[model samples]
Target: MSDRELRPLRSIRITGDGRCLFRSVAYGACLRRGKHPPSDSAQKELADELRAKVADEFVKRRGDTEWFLEGNFENYVRQMRKPHAWGGEPELFMCSHVLRMPITVYMYTSSSDGPRIIAEYGQEYGKDDPVRVLYDGYGHYDALQPSVVRTQSRL
Candidate 1:
């Protein structure tokens, strides 16, 4: 659908207090499961949990590729667990793979027709369900839920 047709039904804004990306992903995961996102403290806790889980999974599954990592796996995991780590494409991909959840990111900027899908990870396991994350050009992320319109009624 076009951007206009895909306006958000609701949005959960994530604070840019150094961990917006992690929080965004955490919130998106909840949305994917058809559940409400957690509060700030809870979201932070969830993000921390996700970070640790993803880090362990990465080492277990991709430890051989440690050379590609900027630092040792231990340090990588340590940084990831920090609240100021600032998750990025690598983290997003890892999270998607580890969690088996499809993630779709929409970026809104001055040079775009509208909010456009900037990144996606993971294969849809059922019903092609995907979690969505929105990135504002100014440096913040939010969970975006598309509005669903019912056009017909049962007779």
Candidate 2:
């Protein structure tokens, strides 16, 4: 379908106004990193397909909004298919923001220490944690969508 046909979901980074967030995110991948990725010999094709389909749906449903595809897919794939040395990290859980969004949406990478950050901040922090520390504590992606993420992560 045409880009215009795509719809935009509510999203933004409060810290930057409309300067930071993205319309949507590839959360499924975020939850499935390390376990599933485009580099895995068994899951490469499936993961790629899923990623593409998700991207298509994202574009179709929320393409109208400001968005960006940020994930460790490229690296994940490389680490998975090296023929010998196979190792790679999962998709990042934090530190991703689309140019048009209002609040930051971070999937929390390993270095960020998601669980610790969550415990220190609480779910509310995930929504508007001015410090922007607790992105993972927002109640899985289902309960704490972007709205909640914004409410708590407001800086």
Candidate 3:
């Protein structure tokens, strides 16, 4: 969101954040060696405090709120907790306002099915709805690859 409060067409992610995740990925890879990996970046210091703040903040604003991550991130976060720094819970950032979205072959049991899912999640809109669910969606790792994106763009 901007000063005008209009949602942007795309997110503004700095390469530094990408490097941060890459560092985590490298750390994850190094852990395959069955040893505690050495820290290589300054991101770890503020990471937990930031995540806790984000989670707590989400919890505060979550009453009757909905959120979307645009991927099957919840499960991946569960499988790789330390790397992602996400607690293994679908409702990790519990808030009435935050509706968890994980793009997967499986939808959450809490959610209703079909096109109605969009209407239900996006009901905040009056005549025109703001929320949408593109079902049969991509998984966590599928989204990371450029090939999947190229194929998806044609759709």
Candidate 4:
């Protein structure tokens, strides 16, 4: 695509703490579901609330299946609900199910293969949903803001 044809995309950085993934998902969810996108402060509040709710859902689901979660489920859920507690693949899967929406994680890398899809959960269930997230190859997550197009007339 030509330079003008391609609109530049930007990433809004999320906290690098353990809650980064959850917070990024929460921000994306709010943008998708809310009437108007909430401010950053409100987004943080929403993310905090989502963290607890997703953690609760994770704990509840543990009872239905055996050998699903490693370690004590109670402690796992407890740590998950707290801010700055690192979230991994399990939490990513649980968040997708609990939110009932797809979570597409884009992973950038230095490899010649280019960026990759690290995870795409609940997509089949919510095919029309635009909610997704971007992961910087490093240990951080960020929200991808929609790219804006500028025509010559506008320029």
Candidate 5:
């Protein structure tokens, strides 16, 4: 694709302090609200807050979530409430429910393919302007934003 046809995408790097997933979602939430990404301190605060809410959400919907959880549901929720606990696919799904918005996860593929959508959550909340995030295969997530490109006027 030509430069003019290609849309520039920017990824906001999230801290990998076991809270990357929450930070990424928080950053994307800000972007979705048409606001600038928060400062690092603010991102951390938001992430922790979101993490707490997600843990609570799991409890609130335990009947539906318990079966899919790998371990004892009570213990799982207890551990997930810890700030250092890493979040994975199940938490991502709970995040969607807690935020009441859809989330779209993209991953980088071969250079030729660029980035592609690997998973999506919260479709029941509607599909418009889902919070976008990039997942590095190893276990990190970053917020994605569509950059605005300005064209120069040719003489």
Candidate 6:
């Protein structure tokens, strides 16, 4: 999509804790389901839950994932299961599998370029709708929502 078409995205900042990725995904999942984002405590709990699920997914798909995983598969899964563990691309991919939904990651560029898609996961599951998240190019991630545009009606 063109920059203009995608300009409606509004980012919801997530806590900068190590679980930011999982928290962003959890927030996006809520918005994808047409629900409001949860409270901070709830989000934290949800993030931890998702983290555990992603680790389980890694184990469940170890036959397919082991080769690409860094270090021993057992160690990787063990680290990912930790509540405060930082998540990255590998966890994002597994999040898609665990949630059974597509995830579209975006990064904001210069003013002229606006926000652009950085990576997308789980397209095989479905592409019609994807949970959107914004990556700040550092280690942090935030949930994105399409801004609602209301047109003024003339009296």
lDDT tens digits, residues 45-108, model 2?
A: 4433333343334444443322343345444344433332211111111212211111222355
Winner on lDDT (2 vs 5): 5
Q: Please, what are the lDDT tens digits per residue for candidate 5 over residues 1-155?
A: 33224345678888899999999999998888889889999999999999999999999998899999988999999999999898989999999999998998989988735567799999999877788889999988988877767879999
Pick by TM-score: 2 or 5, better one:
5
Q: Score each candidate by Cα lDDT.
A: 0.74, 0.27, 0.29, 0.70, 0.88, 0.87
Q: For each candidate, what TM-score against the reference?
A: 0.78, 0.23, 0.24, 0.78, 0.90, 0.91
Which lDDT value does model 3 have at 88? Answer: 18
Model 1 lDDT at residue 84 = 79
Local error of candidate 4 at 144, Å?
A: 1.5
Give the residue spans of candidate 2 off by over 4 A.
1-39, 67-155
Collision count for each candidate, in order: 0, 25, 10, 0, 0, 0
Query: Which 10-residue window of candidate 4 scores lowest in summed lDDT?
Result: 1-10
List the pairs of residues colliding in candidate 1. none
Better of 5 and 6 by lDDT: 5
Sliding window of 10 residues with minimal summed lDDT for model 2: 15-24
Q: What is the C-alpha lDDT profile of model 1 across 1-155, one tens digit per residue?
A: 54466565456688777677777888877877878768999888887788877777667777554666676777876787777777777777778876788888888667865578888887564325577788775667787777677678779
Report the lDDT tens digits of candidate 6 across residue range 15-118: 98899999999998988888888889989999999999999899899999999889999998998888878889999999999998999899988863556888
Ranking by TM-score: 6, 5, 1, 4, 3, 2
Q: Write the per-residue lDDT of candidate 4 for residues 1-155, one digit (tens) a residue.
A: 32223224456778666778887888878776865655667767877887888888876787662266668878777777788787766777777887888787777677734335577887766655445677776667877545665557754
| Cα RMSD for predicted model 3 | 14.7
Candidate 2 vs candidate 3, TM-score winner: 3
User: Which pairs, if any, clash in model 4?
Assistant: none
Error of 2 at 153 (Å): 43
